[model samples]
Target: MIELLVIPANQSQRRPNWLRVKLPVGKEYASVRGLVDTHKLHTICESGNCPNMGECWGAGTATFMILGNICTRSCSFCAVSTGRPLAVDLDEPNRVANSIKLMSVKHAVITSVDRDDLKDGGSIIWAETIRAVRRESPATTMETLIPDFRGIWDNLYRVCEERPEMISHNIETVRRLTKQVRVQAKYDRSMEALHRISEFGLRTKSGIMLGLGETEPDVIETMQDLANTGVHVLTIGQYLQPSKNHHPVMDWIHPDQFAKYKEIGQQMGFKYVESGPLVRSSYHAEKHLFDQVV
Candidate 1:
């Protein structure tokens, strides 16, 4: 088993001031919340308990989660539920598209839970969701934070055929901690997935979280590896432990460190880098559509 740098439970509970988030309270936030609830839609903002939920939702943008809220993989760092998901809701695509249309979202981000139980890894729903969104909201641009499809290239290509503006598959953690942090995922497989997405002619993106006991060298190496895969956009963020049963916080990475990583990522040839303590996969996603930095 891999050794972990376990912070004392009591100390891990106290987060630094930089990690604080404003409460989700505003007209836009409420409006977006209502749309999601009414459409029976799922969002990574709510499912992952993202720290930037308030800021993102208040700005009238959200990263919609399709397929279903229940995920098949139980990554130690995620707050999303893992189990036998309910049957694939075929109407999900239409509902997601309609919700996007109602929100008048100029640029939208869509992601989904892993559906390993499905033979095609849920890529069928993935493609349908993109098509539905494009049909219902003709003017909206999109970035899809997709799953690896368990290395099933045909399934991955199915979604790529729809050609969302950008395709993202998060590395989530460094190679060293892949097994512990993301139990069923492989670092090399994720890299290859990103490479394939880039080769498909769409802009590619990936993200990773710090404070999971990853060393600086591990992070820089990971960035270079991503750049080698033709990834144009990268996001770096601090990892906040989701619950007592989840991975413990190894350290509270300082803002300066995140800023430093951003600089390094930019210098390494990533066209855009959104790096900060509160950064998540889809945080400030619209900016990435045109390769803009945050």
Candidate 2:
């Protein structure tokens, strides 16, 4: 058996103050829960163990996970379950769209796990989901964070066909660490995915995680590469190991470093950069649609 190596248990693994997350609560939060439960929709908030689930749910926004909770890829950095995913639920698109309508969300975020088992990489569903949301909630702007589609342009074209306000494909980490961190995903392919999205004149976005033993220059170089691809927005966040079985946190990055990365990203000509210990791909994503940053 090929045994996986994990970081040793140490005091450094203890989360710092900057990483503290608020517990889910409040009336709006409960209402959102009702929508999620009643409609039987899956969300990245739960699957990805997002830190801002409380804050975002309290504000009546969420990143909906489509296809299924299970992923096709077994990336070391992701917490989403891997193995054989259940058959695709064809009705999920309208369910998610109607849920967004019921919530009266102003800006919606949608994402899906890699479904390489499917012929289209689940891109057809991705496109239909966007169309459903647009039809159900005409006033709601949207951001669609997507998989690499294993670099299939035809499948990618189906997604871009909807012309969502923004399209995000996370590089997840620096180039040198891509093999270990993102496993099945390639650094250049992800960049190319963003480049293709940019070609459509849609607002292109991508995010990278730190604390994976990546160097400062690696980040800067990644930013430069993303800029060259015409990516307009960027997000940087500290990587927290999902569990002992997953990838280990290499080092605890300071808040100041995140701040510096934000500055560096802005200097690189990105329209906006969300960098902080608690930031995630869709953190404060609603604001991204308005060209506003919090």
Candidate 3:
């Protein structure tokens, strides 16, 4: 067993000092909270138990979760609920768009649960949500962190047609752990999805979580895989186990190692790499809107 995993389990379930985050506070966070509640909108920040919810919501940026909260696939590392989702809410796109409008979000990040139950894999709603956001807030840039649509290229094409400022699909773990971590998601399909997205000429991005027992070589190979797909941006974050029921954290990667990975990703030709203990898929996401490293 890896030292970080065995040590933490043996010592009791306490996170390292660096992982501590300020409790969600501030007027801006309160305002964003009210708007989400008012619009009955779902955000990955809340659903996925994102550690940076406080910081992101405080800054008035949110990654909206569309379709519904219930996901079809039960990825072991995720906190989102799994089951048959609610009937597709036709009006959800408008509500999300209106909420972004109310918040005056300059760059909106939209995501959804995997609705594999739907024939089109929820791509219709995906495209519609992008259109609605574009129409409601023309100036607001968008980053859609999307599902793989079960490798149905047509569904993927539907989303690309909208051409959000950036489109991201997370290959949540390395290929070796994909079967264990992501249950129903296939590593090859995800790479193909990103490759197809890159072929569309849109700014492409993807994220992966560390600490699932992935080796440095696994991480580097994953980075190379993503880069081969023309992924313009990459996000690397520590994988904090969502609950005791979820997959146990295999290792708590040190910040220095995270920094080293970021440097390696830069050398691998990624336009940008966000790697840190507390980083999540959409953490500081707005900065990835351009191809240039900021």
Worst 10 residues of 1 by lDDT: 1-10
- List RMSD in Å for every model shown: 3.5, 4.8, 2.6
TM-scores of all models? 0.91, 0.91, 0.92
**Which residue pairs of candidate 2 clash?**
none
Q: Write the per-residue lDDT of candidate 3 for residues 169-244, one digit (tens) a residue.
A: 9998999999999999999999999999998888899999988888888888999999999999999988887778
The residue-by-residue lDDT of candidate 2 on 1-294, one tens digit each, is: 321122323655567766787788898888887877887766778667777987888776777888987898999988889989999999989989987888777778998889999999999899999999999999888999999999999999899989999999998899999998888989889999999989877899999898888778888899899989999889998888888898888877778888888898888888889998899998888777755322
- How many clashing residue pairs appear in each of the predictions shown? 0, 0, 0
lDDT of 1 by residue, 218-293 (tens): 8889999999999999999888887889998887877788888899998999989999889988888877888442
Two-way lDDT contest, 2 vs 3, winner:
3
- Model 3 misplacement above 4 A: 1-12, 25-27, 37-41, 291-294
Q: What's the candidate order when arranged by decreasing lDDT?
A: 3, 1, 2
Clashing pairs in 3: none
Question: CA shift at 207, candidate 2, in angstroms?
Answer: 0.5
What is each predicted model's overall lDDT from 0 to 1?
0.87, 0.85, 0.87
Deviation from truth (RMSD, Å), model 1? 3.5
